[model samples]
Target: MIPKKLASSLLIVALALPGCGLVLENRIERREAAAEAAYPSEGRFVEVAGRRVHYVQEGRGPDLVLIHGASGSTRDFTAGFMERLTDRYRVTAFDRPGLGYSDNVSEAYEGPFNTRSASPAEQAAMLHRAAGMIGIENPIVMGHSYGGAVAMAWGLRHDPAALVIVSGATQPWPGDLGLLYNVTGSSLGGAALVPLLTAFAPEAQVERTIASIFEPQEPPPGYEAHIGAALSLRRASFRTNARQVTGLRPHVTAMSRDYPALRLPVEIVHGTADTIVPIDVHSRPLARQIPGARLTELPGIGHMPHHVSAGAVVAAIDRAARQAGLR
Candidate 1:
């Protein structure tokens, strides 16, 4: 009964849909191949709450747990920082949920809410459970950027000996994460456009994006190769990170209100030149709020203090361990 013109249009769309799906599948395979080639898992996995959580463990002393920021893997610490901590502490670095080699726990969240991805709090719970599996008791929990938010969540509910926040997005920002995150985080864009980006975005573009995150200072030599930036380009990782970031504001707002209850030692390291997670907006106010919290400002450094200013981060950890009476 449909008009001839409309029937023809429907047929055209139906034909195009399969072709588009094929293209997406081809893209996904290529992207996944690139990810595996560049960053094969360098850590062990433990089944935590029905999901395999990837973690890197090394050294022998007081336990220390490292959580990488959004879109980063355990390699973020293995690149260089973990060595510094291993000499005095057993360092275990984790890839946040839905990132790197860690299993995506979005659907496995225990809460009553229906959500596609794990929130920061849920991620903290999963990682904390992973820690328990490995016998990490009251370890110093450290998080950078988005991972910092999860660390705070852990400290609020758990009994971490100390909390170290490095360039953490502790406070909620006022506005959006610009156009890229807004569009990619939405359901429509995530389903339609993420595959195209994963399929064909040039490696140069990915390199450029990583460089920008370490702004005010060029990425350390061989940084691109060591960090496995391609892993971040996978469609699943891209979509999960976009969702985590887009939904972060309210979570940070809710968590920050409970900052006072975190009575354990807290060490915060931030860069004055960090435009990504502005120091003034997050760390400074955090230092003022947490009683006896210490804030160390890295002059002229950008967002990645763990890379650019390794000694300061180590010192903060030392101070925290000492304060927690673990050293």
Candidate 2:
């Protein structure tokens, strides 16, 4: 026996919910359209296991595969850093699955409430298949931040000439990934809050996040515009990134045990001041794990060593090529 007033209130709330959902969906669609228009795909696509993988290929020398971090695209490399190496080595930059213009690994993984994400190994396998389609084989693979996990997976599952990890999150760290990832990655948050973020996240906030990622150093001129930060704000990209980052520790823990088995030339570049992926926790232990792995520590630099200290990164890559007997 429901009271008349209570029943009326419940009915009104139920009626309003659909309209609210409609508005949010409309806004999300508009924002996604604007983001794509401003920063369209900068490279061609190849089909890998029935999914589209976007990549940019340039220069001519040894095959070099570049994997950008979480929420990043090939644009991160194409911005300027890839150009620096073009004269010496052929470079191919890829947008990891579920980010940039690359399609999600599967439709099941795209659902807002779905907790499953493409693992680093899965991403590596897909991209490896795509690389094969484009004739890239036994090449030097480099990964930054989250992409480092994928690069390591590539090395373990397949053969690569060399590996360069920049500010990589290689080992499992203490504690969880904090509120943003934990919340956004959850089933409830992904379905309810993600659309709000996608629809209303401001440009200034994106700039601030970019600055934080490059903390202890400023982002280079036009870096924000070139990196296509807007792409990361789309509902799907945001949800997928949160899911991947939140669920990464367990995968890394499993992967870390296999690090000692890697027998290829490995170069690790990390900033001593990096708080995002602490050097002491990730790079230091990683340097000790791999056989004959070389580590280059940049004092006072932050997570983005490739952007802040491109010369050092290039030097490490050169050293890797030489060590691998490719030079």
lDDT by residue (46-131, candidate 1, tens digit) is: 99867999999999999999998978999889988898889899999998998998887746432212225677888999999999
Highest TM-score model number: 2
Residues 1-327 of candidate 2: C-alpha lDDT, one tens digit per residue: 112343344344434565588877888899999999999998899997789999999999988999999888898998889999989888999989999999988787898888889899988998999999999977999999999999999999989999999999999999887666776788976776667777766677678778888998999998987988888888889889989898889999999999999999999999999999999999999999999999999999999989889999999999999988888
Residue 31 CA displacement from its true place in model 2, Å: 0.7
Question: What does candidate 2 score on TM?
Answer: 0.94
Lowest lDDT sum, 10 consecutive residues, model 1, at 106-115
lDDT of each: 0.84, 0.88
Candidate 1 lDDT: 0.84
Error of 2 at 266 (Å): 0.1
Q: Which pairs clash (backbone N, Cα, C closer than 3 Å) in model 1?
A: none
Off-target runs (Cα >4 Å) in candidate 2 are: 1-18
